[model samples]
Target: MLGAVERPQAWPSFLHQVGVIELGKDRIEGSRLLVVASQANRGATFIAQSVTKQGLMRSYVQNGNPPWLFEFFVNESSNL
Candidate 1:
């Protein structure tokens, strides 16, 4: 899980609800510093493990068993 100190100060609550397993500062070839987020439900068993990276926006999400902190899975991988 992203450490409280490392998490964005103004991050959306919904994103937090989705739950994070890890968030790190790594270098992705073309980028200076990339933030990779390992989601709580994005395990090897899940399907549609999707990752999208556009500019400063990078996201990883997967579709699994049930809803998270909301009625529906946040950042549903179905959209991927």
Candidate 2:
């Protein structure tokens, strides 16, 4: 959802806003996915809903599968 131009910088800020849970090499991939998801979720209400419904599709395409991206829905609703 974030414009392509915004994605690079926006990803980190989005991760911080969503409270990244873990750190290290294992978590790096997940964090990246979460950042992508967060950016998609922030673009607009519809985009947020879409991203949530799709369950990290953008993240998957962008960064491959990350375990935490799957767990994110358990800890936080996409509505936020």
Task: Provide the TM-score for each candidate, comma-separated.
Answer: 0.16, 0.20
lDDT of 1 by residue, 1-80 (tens): 23333465545553654243232223234433234444544542233332222321232323334445243345545544
Highest TM-score against the true fold, candidate: 2
Q: Relative to the unseen true structure, what is the C-alpha lDDT of residue 43 in candidate 1, on a scale of 0 to 100? A: 40
Per-model clash counts, in order, read 1, 0
Best by lDDT: 2
lDDT per residue (tens digit) for residues 20-45 in model 2: 23234346564443334444454444
RMSD of 2: 13.6
Candidate 2 regions off by >4 Å? 1-59, 62-64, 78-80
Give me candidate 1's TM-score against the actual structure: 0.16
